[model samples]
Target: MRVGRELTIGTLSRRSGVNIETIRYYERIGLLPAPPRSQGGHRLYSGEHLERLVFIRRGRELGFTLDEIRDLLGLMVGKHTCGEVQTMALAHLDDIRAKIADLRRMERMLAATIARCQGGGRSECPILDALAGG
Candidate 1:
């Protein structure tokens, strides 16, 4: 892509692999600075917009919330310390670990309950019994 090439929202969505509605939502939420428009009022996204969208998409893929991504983007715009970014990353890492632990616990319980289940013939389902107990 050219350095200054202007792209339509459709083209940007295709190029960045982000949905058009997502792009509009990002703009509305101020995650993305609104782009310039054509005389017809079509949003004309530039390379910068594409780059930012890709960045936002990657952040989302990595499980960052929009607010977290906003904080990271905040770092990109002004003078900042690597320490600040690292701190956020560390906190997010902790959150991921906790979620993984919870998921593992859930998996084990569900697997055990399913194992106890005799399957099709019996009306007494271990899964339902466990759910009822809770």
Candidate 2:
């Protein structure tokens, strides 16, 4: 979509790939600002709002939490340095790496448990036994 057009909520949703409900939720949560209303009480979002929504969607797609996005947005609105942004990003990267490590550990444990299962139908399943803490 072109960047200069004023948009309704629906149009902003389509343009930013965020749903209307999510847009309202973001507004409520202060991630997004409440847009002006038309004379008919319809929301009138600006291109700037559309851009901010797009930034939020992209941040979510990248797995940043809303708080992190809020901080980033705060930094962006201030006269902050790239060093500040990099510090936040590096901390987030460490969190992602830790989560990946934990998932890998879980994968190994699950695979080992499943591998120990001998496939006889009668009753004695190792998977179920393991899950039951036996």
Candidate 3:
């Protein structure tokens, strides 16, 4: 929340908990606005840029795709209602649930296959055999 006339990219990265390369990548990808440069061609970020980077980093941490983040940003700027946001969130939730279910299924299958292994030597390995189309 440090309001200032100018801040270096490093300072902004430290304040926002985002790396400098990521900030530049976001700018290049249009996720963040390109900041003005100093007389020596160094990037000068403002407090607004800092907050926007923080927002983007948080969105990434929350597992949102860049495209989804872009849509959310649009909603933030446009006439977005709670319903729209809720719908998007619910869709993401469904995707997460599906992935969790798939992972649970895989875990169960792996556990069953491993349980068939007795750790004895010279015996056919059930895990390897199962993996080898048995």
Candidate 4:
């Protein structure tokens, strides 16, 4: 869809599901380039802004850090081959696998703690005890 004319930060936020403050934060962190402002100093966003914001949000949803998203954006700006993108994706997949492994370990630990709870009262909750390193 053609996002015509200039869009205010609020409009961009609504359209992209990214918070207005987050857009500013991304600009501050260089993840998103600062856009031109209006005569009254209001930020003016265009279709490109919407597209890039969607890309950033999608990357974040896929478990990429801001730094990694920045790198991916940079790579996207160049004429990279499919092989290069595939390699980067494979690396990200490995990272996702590692995170899944860690989460599984945490789940197992939590399950064991829950199993240990005597279920008599809140004061004796094993989950709380485990969190307290007991």
* lDDT leader: 1
C-alpha lDDT of candidate 1 relative to the true structure? 0.93
Write candidate 2's Cα lDDT for 28-62 as tens digits.
Answer: 99999998898999998998899899999999998
Pairing residues by index, what is the TM-score of model 2? 0.94
Error of 2 at 55 (Å): 0.7
Better of 2 and 4 by TM-score: 2
TM-scores, all candidates, are 0.95, 0.94, 0.88, 0.88
In model 2, the Cα lDDT at residue 17 comes to 96
A best-first ranking of the candidates according to their lDDT comes to: 1, 2, 3, 4
Per-residue accuracy of model 1 over 31-83 as CA lDDT, tens digit each: 99999999999999999999999999999999999999999999988799999
Error of 1 at 95 (Å): 0.5
lDDT (CA) for every model shown? 0.93, 0.92, 0.91, 0.89
**Candidate 1 has which clashing residue pairs, if any?**
none
Off by over 4 Å in 3: 120-123
lDDT of 4: 0.89
lDDT of 1 at 5: 79
